[model samples]
Target: MHELAIADSIVQIADRHANGRRVTKVQLKVGHLRQVVPSALAFSFELVAQGTSVEGAELEMEEVPVTGSCRGCGVESRLKEFPLQCRACGSDDLRVLEGEELFVESLEMEEV
Candidate 1:
C-alpha cells in the first residue's frame, strides 16, 4: 500500500526536524478522502523509522471528515460519500472544502 511510501516521507520529515535528536512523537492530519489506513500507516512508520531519528516515535493521526459546499443553495455540509451531493440542498453542484489532505502537523523531540 501507499502507506509505506507515506510513512517513509513522514520519517524523512521527522528526521530532518529532529536534527540528530530523538523523535518522541509525530502528529499528522489525514483526511477521509485520502483513504489512508491509520493502522497500516502506523505499522509502516515503525518499519521505515528503524535506525532513524524517528525510531520508536509515536504516530498520532487526526482524521478529518469530508466537507462540501453546495453551489446551488450556498449550503455547507459534511459529506459521507463521493460524487458528493450537498446534504442540505441535495444539489449535485458542489465544491469540496475539506478532506483529501495528508500532512505532518507537529513533532515532539528530545535532545540527544
Candidate 2:
C-alpha cells in the first residue's frame, strides 16, 4: 500500500530530525485525495519504525478536505474527488484551492 511507503518516509524524516532523541508523536496533514487510512498508516509506521529513533511514536493525522473554486460562477465547493466542478453553474472552470496534500506538520520528542 502507498501508506507503507508514506509511513517509511515519515519515519526516516523523523529519525533524522530526532537526532538521537526519542520521538513521542508525529503530526501529519493528509488530504482527502490521499485516501490514506490513518489506522493502517499508524500500523505501518510501527512496523517501519521498529528499533528506530521513532519507535513507539504516535502517528497523528489531520484530515484536510478538498476544496474547489469556480472561476465562471465565483462559487466554491468541497470536492469529494478529482475533476472539480462548480456546484452552482455545473462548470468545469474550477480551480483547486486545497487538498492533494501530504506533509508533516510537526514532531514531538523527548530526551533520550
Candidate 3:
C-alpha cells in the first residue's frame, strides 16, 4: 500500500526535525478527499519506524472534511458527493477550498 511510502516519508521528516532526539508523537492532518485510511497509515508507520527514533512513537491523525464554495450563490458548504455542485444554488461552478491535504501538523520529541 502507498501508506507504507507515506509512513516512511513521515519518519524521515520526523527524524530530521527531531535532531537526534527520540520522537514521542507525530500529529498529522489528512483530508477526506485524500481517501487515506488512518488505521492503515498507523500500521504502516509502526512497520516503517522499526529500529528508528520514531519506533513506538504515537501517530495521531486528524481527519478534515471536504468543503467548497459556490461561485453562483457565494455560499460555502460541505461536499458529500462528486460532480461538485452548489447546495444552495445548484450551480456546477464551484471552487474547492479544502479537503485535499496531507501533512504533518506537529511532532513531539523527547529530550536527549
Clashes in each model (backbone N, CA, C under 3 Å)?
Answer: 0, 0, 0
Quality of model 3 by C-alpha lDDT = 0.89
For candidate 1, which ten residues in a row score worst on lDDT? 80-89
The sequence of per-residue lDDT tens digits that candidate 1 reaches over residues 57-107 is 999999998898889999998976776788887888878799988999999
Better of 2 and 3 by lDDT: 2
lDDT scores for all predictions? 0.91, 0.91, 0.89
List the candidate numbers ranked by lDDT, top first: 1, 2, 3
Q: Mind sharing the TM-score for model 3? A: 0.88
- Scored against the true structure, residue 33 in model 2 reaches a CA lDDT of 78
lDDT string for model 2 (1-112, tens) is 8989999999999999999999999999998878899888989999999999999998999999988889998999997866667889989887878888998999999965
Q: List the residue pairs that clash in candidate 1.
A: none
**Maximum-TM-score candidate:** 1
Which parts of model 3 are misplaced by more than 4 Å?
80-83
> For every candidate structure, what is the RMSD over all alpha carbons to the true structure, in angstroms?
1.4, 1.8, 1.7
Ranking by TM-score: 1, 3, 2
Error of 1 at 19 (Å): 0.6
